[model samples]
Target: MKLSSGTIRLIIPAASLALLLAAVFYMQPRAMSYTGLNLLFNLAIPIALATIAQMLIMSINDLDLSMGTFVSFCACVAATVLQTSPLLGALIFIGAIAVYAGMGMLIHVRDLPSIVVTLGMSFVWGGLAVLLLPSPGGTAPTWARAIMTAKPPLVPMAIIASILIAAVTHYIVMRSSFGVLMRGTGGNDRSVERAGWSVIGIRAATYALAGLFAIFAGIALVGLTTSADANIALRYTLLSIAGVILGGGEFVGGKVSPIGAVIGALTLTLAGSFLSFMRISPDWQIGAQGAILIVVLALRLALNRLEKREKHQ
Candidate 1:
């Protein structure tokens, strides 16, 4: 029996992940201890969140180039507000919600291309981040830090929390009406709109979801880094996009897979870890990831063509 196109698309990345695991074990030549597991957890959590943020927007056939910059903005602002008061810090988080919501509305109303809008927003938000903290060196209040760092004594609760959140998020997206509508929008917004759904509203919701994910990502980063800095969110914009593409999500939108995005995040985190363990330089990572993504994109296109041709036959 033949597989569906979506199943075919996921195969390569799944196999690539299995191969990545093999490479790690072969290179390490050692059993993975609790410490090693913990290290992986640390790498996985933020990256997974970042990937989810990107995936949310991609699901609606929109791009959010400002995600990293927004995340940095959230972190910097949260740090500043916490210094004043926890209530203020909470307000700033809500403000991020508002900021992103407004931006989403702008995109929907202006009908500007998502990539253009988000890229410009990235610079704007990044500038705000600089203005907020200048050069970093601010501390998140101890209370905020403690809550993020707090873990169940018996287990790596941070990892557990992330997994549970990802699971529930996946379930909601897969089992809900919103999920079906969003998927329909992704596949063909025009057709979906003909069916009486508002494409703009769905798209805006996607960006809002992305913004929430960024907020959570920012908090996680604060816990991990213990300080807010400028340019913190910059790298994530590209990295998250790369992760989504690598996970078999179409760069052009109309397809979103939470599990695929998670696997993609895992692939990136493990690849970076393997490279670091081998003493490879950081500069090489971007090139390596780009090459991998290009290959995946090409394979997806080739597979898509094959499916179309077979159907025609």
Candidate 2:
């Protein structure tokens, strides 16, 4: 039977998630319990949000090398200014979003590689975060903590939040008319320009949206930890990119999926937990993640080949 591109995309994430779930359950049956699930998924909200942020940039055929530092900066702001001066924190966050928009504009105007621009911005963000919080000691605001600690009925808050993130982002980026335009700009800027749209504006809006999501991720991280550090979320950069790819996003051509990204994040989160349950060393955990990513990518490649052969036949 021939599988369509959409089916092929869905298969990878679905299969990967199922396999992870099976492995986790097999390794520890107790993980099926509510408390265990809560523990496992506690950190998923922030990762899912970060993955969405990465997905937004990937959807535009661009990448934000600074996303991790940018998120850490927001966490620093949340821990310091947001806790002490709410008004100031709001303004700072707004300024950060504007900077993201400006980066998009600069990239478009200069026709510069997104990687080069964002890589430089990463250092700036990291420096600002260090300046804001030299140590990991600031507290999360009461409101932020309350939101993160809220216990909903039947399901864990992390799961609920992940679902909502996936649903909301999917609607905004995959269903809305404006979404089509944004994706069109990524898929083919010249074509979109000919269609009477400002490609630059679309790109800027996408970056701003990504920044907004990253802010949510940072705040969530602070809420969970009740503190912040300049280097707190540095690992998120590579993890988020991996999540997007595992979830069926491409590096170019505007191919991306919000739901898949969330699923991908969840799978990776579970993979880490599964490894920890088996007493894997922290050093090996990172390597395990890389290995899992490689295996999934290889599976995706095989699926693509199968699809092509089926079509030819």
- For each candidate in turn, the TM-score is 0.86, 0.97
Cα error, candidate 2, residue 61 (Å):
1.2
Q: What tens digits encode model 2's per-residue C-alpha lDDT throughout 1-313?
A: 7556866787988898888888888889998877788888889889999999999999889998888999999999999999999999999999999999999999999999999999999999999999999877899999999989888888988888989999999999889987898778779989999989899999899999999999999999999999999999998998899899999998988888889999888988988998898789998998988888899889989988988887799
Candidate 2 deviant stretches above 4 angstroms: 1-4
Return the TM-score for candidate 2, rounded to 2 decimals: 0.97
Clashes of 2: 0
Question: Model 1: per-residue lDDT, tens digit, 170-189?
Answer: 77566688888877887888
User: Deviation in angstroms for 171 in model 1?
Assistant: 1.8
RMSD of each: 2.9, 1.4
Count of clashes, each model:
1, 0
